[model samples]
Target: MATPIYEFAQIPRVDPAAPARARTRKVRAAGQAPTVGVIYNPRSHRNLGADFDCSLSPHVHIAQPRARAQLPEALADFAAKGIDLLVINGGDGTVRDVLTCGQAIFGDDWPEIAVLPKGKTNALTIDLGIPDDWTLQDAIDALDQGGRVWRRPIAVSPAEDGASAAGMSRVAGFILGAGAFTKATQAGQSAHKLGAFDSMVVAVTGVWALLQSLFASRANPWRKGARMRIGLGASGVPMEHSGHGDPEMRQLLFASTLERLPAGIRPFGALKNGLKLVAVDQISRRTTALIPLVLLGKLRGGLRERGIHQLTASHFTLSIDDQFILDGEAFPAGDYLIGQGPELAFVTP
Candidate 1:
């Protein structure tokens, strides 16, 4: 049985507040002739599906479908080709890589991104309404028709201290987090060789890892639990220290880009162009609480009053016990602090 949502009170609240957003911004509408770059990561399941529908797109200036050691080369090639929009055909990791690559090669004036939900858990793409089953022909057709595409702002981590200080340290397109949730994702990825592309499978695997860590991992998780000292914000304001303060003790601190999670238990205002911040202390209760409310795709029986779907934080960081997963890919610097890494900018479909 899962624990209760109230258990989250065990988590210390950070000064995280709602994201302050102005009107949505757009770089290129559908009709504009935006030169496209296709940096497909063939290794991920999402990019390999449906006969490589992404690679076959007529609009994109295609490069080899892989994340090279020195990714800047690929971006240089695309930029040299004058590609205006960079279409990423992979999961969250791939998307993150693309952002870094863009920063390295193009700096702040980089191409906008269009994602193909070719990842295991396409939480962001799904939020963007990029269908689970998309065809290249359809996308091309839509672009030709100048379909009404939606645009959303991607979050950027506060500038860090380094050669690439202005570069993105972290960019959350769909979700960013620390704590047990990150550990769970890292653990689940250990079995990546035996994993599937389906979101349900990945979620189950992530949960398995969470349980394993709770019960068996060598880490001292139970006594102290996973806690991080972070500051969150939105609309460019700090949301990390007050009635909406940072959590003193949290098992999982997550900020999501979309309103809904699995089974359509979307956070409020996610679809309305905002992010959601949730700090979790007891997974069992959260699981239970969110489960019943997930009736097909709508909330029911007093479940809707549980939490807010929209939250914002500008400077959020954590001290974690395990490596966290950004989107789906795990990093080598997984164990250390990534002072504001990975930035995400979006493109309308």
Candidate 2:
């Protein structure tokens, strides 16, 4: 069977009023091994059908959750053990599921995280400068010797009206995209089957998307975009439209807390850090032709006037007529509040 991308979506809604468990880092004695917990996904691109090596010390605990329902139990068990390091041995989807389930358990006080880039798209690891060959032993050793990189995952919650009666259903992830981005993600999957992974997949899908937009008519999905309203910050200020094409429809919407993407693409231009976003209006083919330069960080000036809007905000709201993607998983179309999750420390060499 194929790996299910919607595993995180199966997680039940968490109550808003329930008191979150306070997570505290485990302190090891001198010369003692630090307690480690690993959430290993057997279905990850690199780990498929391979048995996990069990030669490690007893201090390292590994959990192979076959479904999303088992993630919370595994994470809670880790918390009870006072694990010093939480290693995610999978790609972005696995990271999203772990972080989402861990919210109720770890709250904002999480153990130092170490990600082994064992998936097709390891965007978070790329941002943390983790090498593809990083191993579990390396992560344990890095706990003492390696540097630390701080990052915040983007937190997405349903709008008040669309929320569950108990509370809003929230999911945490690094990359969120809609409009043409959703189509590109679908195309990326096709590239994966052709044996293209990581940056190569990005290049393949990006070039394909650009070509489609350049040659297709305005009625095409690539050029027509999606109908969505983007509100900036807490005040819900309307995002300015450049009067390029249809003011009501945007050609693309991409948001992320990660600074470095897989292909070194800079969609946010000069705006880095915080919650940065790029919203493109239903621009003309002439403007669509400049997307490469914009993504390369070369076409910076007068972007807003040319139908490209790149800005940073504490939070943003989205009301869309079509489905959006978060960490390669599709979410139903609805209103949502997007903000940054707690700052997490990632172990890096």
How many clashes would you count in candidate 2? 0
lDDT of each: 0.48, 0.87
Question: Cα-based RMSD of the predictions, in order?
Answer: 10.0, 2.0
lDDT of 2: 0.87
lDDT of 2 at 201: 91
Give candidate 2 misplaced runs (Cα > 4 Å).
Answer: 1-9, 162-168
Clashes of each: 45, 0
lDDT of 2 by residue, 206-316 (tens): 999999999998799988889999999868999999998888999999999998888989999978788999999988788889999998999999889989999999998
Best prediction by TM-score:
2
Candidate 2: minimum summed lDDT over ten consecutive residues — where? 1-10
TM-score of each: 0.63, 0.95
The segments of candidate 1 whose C-alpha lies over 4 angstroms from its true place after superposition are 1-34, 46-60, 106-112, 146-173, 187-196, 202-224, 233-248, 267-272, 282-310, 331-349
Clashing pairs in 2: none
